[model samples]
Target: MPTIWLFAIVLVTGLAGFALARGRAVASAGGDTRVMHSRPLYHGLNGLLTAMLPALGLLVAWLILQPVLLDRAVVGAIPPEVLEDGAARSLVMADVRRVADGLDAAIAAGVATPEGLAALTAEDDVRGLLGQAGVALGSDVSPYVLEAARDMRATAATLRVVMWVAVLAVLAIGLGVALKRSHADYRARNFVERGVLVLLVAAASIAVLTTVGIVASMLFETVNFFSQYPASSFFFSTNWDPSFSGRGGGSELGIVPLLWGTLYISFIALLVAVPVGLLAAIYLSEFASKRMRSVAKPVIEVLAGIPTIVYGLFALITVGPLLRDAIASPLGLGNSASSVMTAGLVMGIMLIPFVSSLSDDIINAVPQAMRDGSFGLGATHAETIRQVILPAALPGIVGAVLLAASRAIGETMIVVLGAGAAAKLSLNPFEAMTTVTVKIVSQLTGDTDFASPETLVAFALGLTLFVITLGLNVLALYIVRTYREQYE
Candidate 1:
């Protein structure tokens, strides 16, 4: 709900500010920035930025700080004895909140019993007497303590309401202002077009920001994890029994077996996905009739739309046993569908659209002029496609493959269901294997204490995955840039 509110507020502010600027500028004598400095749309955008930027900063700060301030005030009210025990701090706070809420509810309901009434009366009387004694006897502390407690409670409630009101008011004010300017001379089309561009850029920036946040979060946690477990052991040790004790009575947090499993399963998935996907893409792009493409493209995309969890179930219940008897047993592999092959194959099927769709787009985007030039040179369609079109689209093809690889590496559910949870560094595709994603899921899926290496290790694995994906994306961007030059 807060998220939805935040979005609505930001959008309203942006639109309102944009509209106001456009209106004021149009009404001015020399306001046309392009006709006088820049376009009317740019003027509107400039206003939007001015209005929303500072206020949104305040909104973000308020959102982050409100909970911390409330939590601290509530915690500070607890008695000192409860704070000394490690667990008592939490327990007493819960009880104190329950008592406060019960008091509020009882007072509201008019059902407060004699004991409840007596206890509250006693507390008030003691506080009042303490206050009078503090004033009459010239003691400086008792009245102040009571006053401070009351002030804290009231202030917390006030701050909560003010924050919500501020958020809603900002939204309502912004929306009202934007609507007020939607007149005939508002130039809505130009304003909307420019806004759409900004919106797209903002959307793209979130992906970059999300990647940065993940890396930064994992970096700090990984540092903590490495402090507890030596880096060498985590990277090179052949075992990955995180529940085991270290030589120094610490937890065993080695990663060799998990890394091995990740690579094996990913390799199998790539083996299954790449050739099939590439050939299908090649055929569809170069040979398929327009009618076939119309039918096939949507069907392939539908595969991508299927949820990964569904594929996981398909692997667990249907594919595992089928492979155990049909493939594994015949090949002298273990008779289990939860082998590397089962998950890898199903995951490969999942990734086919990823590879094919991207490749198709790149291949199709290759200029028709190049195809015509090859034809004019008396080259066959196949030859022209292989030599000219593919070469021109090579960088994009590589980018697509890299993207598919990243998807395969990060996939969790299918592997979790189809691959056995054995963290062994075995080369046999028929034997069950695990992956980093699977290990991360297994480690962090339940009620886990943050202090334990078992839980912290997931952050480390996440850091590794983030780094790998980041590297791949950067490489893809570079390749795409270089390929853009070829077409240009």
Candidate 2:
């Protein structure tokens, strides 16, 4: 049977066990709700948990292990001469899996009978037979590989049967045991609660585990990249060229220009976002009337909901050309439509909602008493805001700006469409440049070998970006904590 069918059967069995167990518990309580220790729903949930959890756990383990065992067995059957290296063995295994799938497809399509499939031999025209069934093989089947594939099919079929029987048997046993325990005095509520707590804990742990997995994966590939390419050259050199060939001597895999562009663009973005967003927040929170605040807040936040790619397109089609003709050409600056200024300006607009929303919340979080106290001291509204309110909310405002900075730094689409793909360290905002994220995309695009330094350098760039963001977050936290402690 297919795995999906098996899963459906198991689910249905659990649901049935839930109803049966609930009915049995009610009957045991003489159909009197006051007699039982827990509700009928709790009893039903206990039965469901008992029936599904262990059986499903076993099913998952079997699914994971069965493939490894099957691959080992089939690979073992291949002759040593045919298994020359990892790549060659992988190729042979690919053929084995393809032939195995082709046989099943041929039988199902009615182009080959079961008996005909059984009679397939290595010396026979296996490729021709498969092709007739609309399954093309890259090469003719060898005797060793053909025999291994036949063995793999037989093994997989037997394992499927075994898996079905084992899962069903466990489900039956668990359901029967839970049903037997479904008495008026049983602690079904406690059992269900414990199961729920375990599930919640597992859900929470997944985030931490996923973060660990990402870091470990990047670190491993980055180490491999550094082993092949010099770390000093990658970090210090100004050039940013990547030769696609795996033979790594020709490529100038420098990260300086990319890093410079990233920081330069992010700096420009923050220059635009921080002031406009902060002023908007201040006006809305302290100065605007209630109706104006309500209307303006959502209107400003709507910018956040619009997708980043739309912002990228806006930068490319509308903003880039306007900047080049109206500002750059008149000012005797560079005339490229795609330049650092175009992307930064567009990215800043994209970041405005993030800064405004977060800063609005943080500014409002300041106690109204501070403002009242400042006003009682005969201070003007602007003076009260500048002296009392901003100082009180400085830490949170810093955090909001830092978050917006990180968003600007990590932005990809805006930089790609607005900033041209020319990695350079330049002072002029109208000059074309690219960021680390753009280069990472460029390096990893197309048919790539993970073993090559050119491809693996993407991971190194990613790790570096991760570190920079981490440092920014840490610095923000330190500043916030230190500032807040002064008031506390």
Candidate 3:
């Protein structure tokens, strides 16, 4: 049976077990609710959990293990000549799988008989027959590959049948045991509660596991990159050229220019975002009327809801050209539409909502009594805000700014569309420059060779970006904690 059909059967059985167990519990209590240790609902949930959990666990394990075991068995069956190296073995295995799938398709379409397929040989034009049945092959089928493919198909079929039988047997056994234990004095509520707590812990562990997986994968690839390329050249050199083919020893893979562009663009973005967003937040939280606040806050937040790609397009067609003509060219800075200024300006506009919304809430969280006390001490409104409200909210405001800075640094779309793909360490904002993210995308695009430094360097770049962002977060936390303690 199909996996989905098996899942449906298990689910239906569990649901049926729930109803049966609930009825049994009520009957054991003599239809008196107060006589039972737990509610009917808890008893029902206990039965459902018992019927489903073991069966689902077995099914998942079987699915993960089956392919691996079958692949090993098939690989053993193949001739030693075909298993030359890792890449060669992988390619041959791919062909074996494709041929197996094609044979299955041909049989399903009635274009090939089972007996004919069993009797097939390499000399019998197997690829032509498969092609006639709409299964194309890149090369002629060899005898060894054909044998391996046949073995793989047969093993997979057998394992699938075994999986279904085992899962069903477990489900039946669990349901019987759960129903037998459903008595008036049974601790069904405690069992169900413990199971729920286990599930919650498992859910939380997934996030931690995901972070570990990301770090491990990047670290492995970065180690490979550094093994082939010198660490000193990658870190300290100012050049940024990468040879697509891993042929040249002269390919400069330095990250200095990329890092400079990233920081420079982020700095410009913050220069525009911090003042505007902070001022807007102060006005909205402190001065705006209720009617205006409601309307204006939502309007400003709508910018955050707008997609980054839309902002990229705005930067490309509108903002980039506008800056080049109106500001950069007139001031004799540069004539390029795609420049650091264009991307930074558009990215800043995109970050405004992050700063304003967070700062507004942080400012509003300050106690009203603090402001009142300041006013009674003969301080003016402006003095009261600067000395009392902003000071109290300074930690949160700094955190908001740091968060915006992180967003700016990680931005890709605006940098790609607005800033041209030229990794440069120039100081002029009007000059075209690209960040590490843009180079990462460029290096990884198209038919990439994973073993090449050109491709592997993307992982190194990713790890660097991760470290930079992590340091920023740590700094933000430390600052927030220090100031928060003083206020408390």
Most accurate candidate by lDDT: 3
Instruction: TM-score winner between 1 and 3, please give it.
Output: 3
Q: On residues 318-411, what C-alpha lDDT tens digit does candidate 1 reach at each position?
A: 9889988887799787876788888888899999998899999989998899999999999998899888998898887888789779989999
> Please, what are the lDDT tens digits per residue for candidate 3 over residues 376-402?
999998998898999899998998999
On TM-score, the leading prediction is 3
For model 2 the local lDDT of residue 316 reads: 93
Better of 1 and 2 by lDDT: 2
Quote each prediction's TM-score: 0.71, 0.87, 0.88
Q: Residues 1-488, candidate 2: write the lDDT tens digits.
A: 68999899889989988998899999999999689999999999989999988889899999989988788879877988768754357668878988988888888888888787778888999998889889998778988888888888889998999999999999999999889999889999999999999999989999999999999999998998998899999999999888875458489989999999999999999999999999999999988999999899999999999998999999999999999999999999988899999999999998898888888898899988888999999999999989888888989898889889889888899999999899988899999999999888888887666667788899999999999999998999898898887667
TM-score of 3: 0.88
Looking at model 3, residue 209 earns an lDDT score of 99
lDDT of residue 303 for candidate 2: 93
Name the runs in model 2 displaced over 4 angstroms.
Answer: 61-74, 77-159, 247-249
lDDT of each: 0.73, 0.90, 0.91
Q: TM-score: which is higher, 2 or 3?
A: 3
